[model samples]
Target chain A: MGAPLTTRGNAPKQDRSRATRRRLLQSAVACLAERGWTGSTVAVVAEHAGVTRGAAQHHFPTREDLFTAAVEYVAEERSAVVRDLPRPAGVREAVEAVVGLYTGELFRAALQLWVAASNEPQLAPRVVALEARIGRETHRMAVRLLDADESAPGVRETVQGLLDMARGLGLANLLTDDGARRERVVAQWAAVVEAALRG
Target chain B: MGAPLTTRGNAPKQDRSRATRRRLLQSAVACLAERGWTGSTVAVVAEHAGVTRGAAQHHFPTREDLFTAAVEYVAEERSAVVRDLPRPAGVREAVEAVVGLYTGELFRAALQLWVAASNEPQLAPRVVALEARIGRETHRMAVRLLDADESAPGVRETVQGLLDMARGLGLANLLTDDGARRERVVAQWAAVVEAALRG
Candidate 1:
């Protein structure tokens, strides 16, 4: 979870500041996954991060600021995970990997925040922007994993469908134990993607 | 919106009673879609339904009962709509129609409940049961609409994937205007399904 502490401007305090920010963001993600948006209060996040409330406030002046930063932080982490995945040998393995990504802890945490943002006016715009950015990055990863040509007639949309199906499966898994069923869907969709590529 | 008033045991009071229940359920749906779960109180629903507080209480004694009933009610309504859709001439039209069904008012209303239920322990079990029932009915509708064989290798899963993709698109549409993008995905998926069927 630790990134290499690079000094931006000031050399002396840079490492400590980066470590503090990372801890706070990670704590916020945990709080969101466990307690949801309304329950993930600043004080609770600060306590979970082992930081004083004042320090937390100093880092994030408002609840929205804290959550927005946490959402972006998690997105970057997950993106790196996806980018660093060992290239799958075939469509089935690739589909499985993507599905695993969607059904993981990061997706669960993001889902909680998404639900919270839907009904919250102040948080809605930021969440929407974050989702758009994440969606683009995920699509790019899918295209690369599939070795797809974006200029091809139906290739891009097919990749989008794959991504959408994974998301749908993730949503279903939120309330139901659909692991076996999700595997079958992934295999079938993988076959379809393979066929689409062949054409 | 009106169900036929049946006189199974009580003759005279059945129609008004059924109407009252329908109104309450519909009001609950509106409240959920507009204000989410926390804001959709029994009092607010009763007022929206134009029913007396006592009558609302008589119909649904608890908040859980009201929401659970509403969730089931909306699912049944949406299922009926899907079942009643005129059969399409081909797969593309069928896919388009199915996507339309998902992105409609019912899906939006149901999305709110789903998000609410995911985090609320008391609501989770009922939502899960409702989702399973709804999933079964939807799979049946898709199979019928596509003239698909469940026993055939990979066919049932392809159908399931289509349903799941529509659900994902519906979820995405909740926060962002993904209608144009959703249509592209639907068209591309229809092409894949058609090719698979031909093969």
Candidate 2:
């Protein structure tokens, strides 16, 4: 993975540099989703972004740098999407929305990165830290979206269980067409969560 | 990955051949847990098994074959462990046993394979089929152990959700030391399960 490139001789126009970096990060995510971590090299990302190798290097010097940026970039973009979604009216709707959030392209890209990071020594620490931050943010978002009562006994665990099950479903979907089964799991879990809230 | 080697020339003594195969499978699991898929090459597995390259080759011809066998071997071993574990006296104990079963070395080995199979085209189909089978068996066992009423509304979903959550916890434990948090999730979930049963 590439290290973040330091600003070099005479800062390039800020807007253009930012745009180039954005493009590279987007390209890196695309590569990760389609080809996985090993396949998504700096050169490949640059090519995908239609930028020169030097331009890519100027933005992300190491593969780690590029991957780290991509992971953060995708997480923020997904978080924004979650934040923008209309607040769900009931537990069922909330479950559907939350499950949808987890089953999208963002999840796939993140899964690829997680699998890659799990094996790579150089990338493991960064990925672990990123996942922790993302997991916490995701949990917070879910609690808010569901209007879940944190003060209620077992509420936190209920929320955590929902999030974890969504992740497992996301993983299952990665290998096979698990949409039907995933829907059932979500609905069942929604019922459980509803029961907990009421009790 | 190695393809299963056909019996070539007078089969070496059956006992010795079986022993060699077992050793290789054990070595492959150890390698996967420690070195991951990319690093657990045929040469490395053979070296770790203390078997000559030719002897290892006589059992597994391709890396895929070796990994495939190792996956099955580990799954069978784990299934036996689950089968032999004393049945729980209550839902909480059942949950603890199930959770403990998931958060062990077997889960780690299986996880490495899952991550590898996710990215490797050659291994994906086998892994998918194996996972589906294991999942179904696991679900059945959970229902049995919990004495869950299958005909009850949401019973299937409850079981499925638990399994999915356990898998998620297993995945989380892979990236970080999530033991304390996992215990909380398990305890909370067990309470929910007990409530669902009584309700």
- Give the whole-model CA lDDT for all candidates, comma-separated: 0.82, 0.82
Residue A60 local lDDT, model 2:
87
Model 2 ranges with Cα > 4 A deviation:
A1-12, B1-12
Clashes of each: 0, 18
List model 1 lDDT by residue over B133-172, tens digit each.
8778878888877777777788888888888888888888
RMSD of 2: 6.2
Classify candidate 2 by CAPRI docking class: medium
Model 1 chain A: lowest-lDDT 10 consecutive positions: A1-10
Overall local distance difference test of candidate 2: 0.82
Q: What TM-score against the true fold does each predicted structure earn?
A: 0.91, 0.91
Candidate 2 lDDT tens digits, B1-199: 4434774433557768888899999899888877777788999999999999988888998888888788778778777877877778999988877677577666776777776676789899888888887788788788877888889888888888788778777778876789899888888989988887767
Error of 1 at B191 (Å): 0.7
Which candidate should be chosen as best, given TM-score against the real structure? 1
Residue-level lDDT of model 1, residues A164-192, one tens digit each, is 88888888888767899898888888888
